[model samples]
Target: MEFVILTGLSGAGKTNALHAMEDSGYYCVDNLPPLLLETFYDLCDNSTDNRMKKVAVVADARSGEMFADIPEVISKLRLEGKQFKILFLDAKPNTLLVRFKGTRRKHPLIGEIASGSIEEAVELENELMNGVKAMADYVIDTTFMNPNELMERVTTLFSAGAHDTLLVTCVSFGYKYGLPPEADMVLDVRCLPNPFYIKELKPLTGLDEQVRNYICGFDVMGEFLDHLYAFIDYLISLYRNEGKSELVIGVGCTGGKHRSVTVARMLNTHLLENGQKSAIHHRDIWKA
Candidate 1:
C-alpha cells in the first residue's frame, strides 16, 4: 500500500489535486484530522488484503491543532513502516488572492481578504507551514501551471515512477511529399523501394502486409528497430530522472501516408508494451 499526504497554503488547488488523485484510482480523504491519523493507518493496515493500494490524504491548517501535530503523526507512520510521501502545492500570493476574489470566498488563513492589500494572516499561516513544506517529497508551484498540467505531473509521478520522464512527440509530414522534420531519430524505408511503385500496393494502405514486408526487408530496418528500442528505453529512464514533461520522436519517410504511419504505429506499440504513456496523431497523413 502507498500513501500520499497533500498539504499546502489555502487556494493552492489541493481540492483539485485530490480529485485528480481520485480519478487516478487513489482512495482519497479530504481534510482528515491529525488525531485520526493513527486510527486511519490502522484501518488501512488491516485492509491491505482488500486491494486498496493507493491512498491520498489532504491535511492542512483547516484542522486546527491537527495541523500542528502533523510532524509527529508523520513520524509515527514512518516508524510503523507505512509507505508515504508528501506533496506540497504553492501559488503566488497575487494569484491566490485573485482566485479567492473570483470565488467570493474568504481565505482559510485570513477571514476576509481585501482586494489590493496582502493578508498578514495568510502570511503567518505560510510561515507556520514551513515545517511541513520542508518535509515535502515533491513541491509544485501552481502559480503558472493549469489543472491539466498539474494532473499530468501527478499521474507521471505515480504511474511512471519517481524517475520516469514525460515525452511529448509531434510527428508531422506531408502525404504527397517525403518525410517531415529533422527527427531526433529517423527511419527511411524510401530505398527499401516503395511498394507504392507496385500497382496493387499503390492503391492499398501501408496496413497491407505486402507493403509492410517490402519496407521491413531492408537490413537497416531491423537494425533501426533494435537501436530505437534500446534508445527509447534509456530515454524513458533518463527523462523520468530529469523531470522532463515531454519528448518528441518523429518517424518519417517519403510520403507521410504509408511508411511513416506504419513505423509510428510500430513505435507506439513498443512504447505501450514498455509501460510508457503515449498518443499518436496522423498529422498530414489525411490532409486535403
Candidate 2:
C-alpha cells in the first residue's frame, strides 16, 4: 500500500492538493487525527479492495493537540516497516495572508489555540510546523502558483512511477521583477547578446523562430549552453543522490523577453532530449 501524508500551513492550499490527489486516483481523507493514522493504515492495508492501495491523508494543524502526536505516529509506522512519504505544502507568510483575506477565512491558530493577529498567527503556525517541515520528503512552495499550476505540480509529483526521479522546472524571468523565491539554482544569462537590441527581434519573444535563431546565432551562446548543460547534468545527479524530489532553475536576463527565455528553452530542450521530466515558465514574458 502507498500511504502519503499531506500536511502544511493553514492557507497553503492543502485542501486543493488533497482534491488533486483524489482526482489522480488517490483515496484521500481530510483532517485525519494523528492518533488514528495507524488504525487507518491498517484498515487500508488489510482491506480486500484494490482501490484502497493508494491512500493520501491530510493531517494539519487543525487537529489541535492531536496534531502533536503525528511525529510519534510516523516513527511508529517506520518501525513497523511501513514506508510513507510526507508532502508538505507551504507559501510565504504574505501570500498566505493575502489568500486568507481574499477568502475571508479564519486562521486555524487565531481561535482557542492562540490569540493574536493574522500575521502573528501565521508566524506562530510556521514555528509550530517546523519539525514536520524538516521531515518532509517534498516541500512545495505555492506562493506564486495558480490553482491550475498547483494541480499540475501535485499531479507531476504524485504520478505513479514518476516520483523516483527528480523533476526540474526552468523558469525565465526579468531581473526587474525580482527572482523566483522557489528557485534552487539561478542562472544569469544576461551576459549573452540581447535580442531586444535588434529592431526586428525586439517585438518577438524567444518562442518565435526568428528570435530563437538570432539568440542562438552567437558563438558564445553555443559555448555557454555546452557548459550549462554539463553543469546541470552533474548537479542533477548529485541532487538525486541527495534525495531531492524537485529542482527549480531560474534563468534571468534584463527583461525576460529575449536572452533568458531563449536559454531557458534551450535547457528545456536538453532535458527533454535526455528523457527527463521538466517544465518551462516565462514568468515575465508579457510584462511591459
Query: Which model scores highest in lDDT?
Result: 2
- After superposition on all CA atoms, what RMSD does each candidate show versus the true structure? 10.3, 2.4
Clashes per candidate (backbone, < 3 Å): 8, 0
lDDT of 2 by residue, 1-288 (tens): 788999999989898898889988899999999899999999999999988888999998899877878888888898998867899998999999999999999888887444558998898889878888888877777876788778777887787632457888888999998888778889998888888988988998988989989878888878988899999999999988897877889999999888888889999999989988887878788888
Task: Please report, as a residue range, the 10-residue window in candidate 2 with the lowest summed lDDT.
Answer: 156-165
Error of 1 at 196 (Å): 40
lDDT for model 2, please.
Answer: 0.86
Best by TM-score: 2
User: For residues 133-211, could you state the per-residue lDDT of candidate 1 as single tens digits?
Assistant: 8777666656645677667656655554322345434353443543433234454544445665777776655556777
Show pairs that collide, candidate 2: none
Worst lDDT run of 10 residues, candidate 1, spans 175-184
> How does each model score on TM-score?
0.55, 0.88
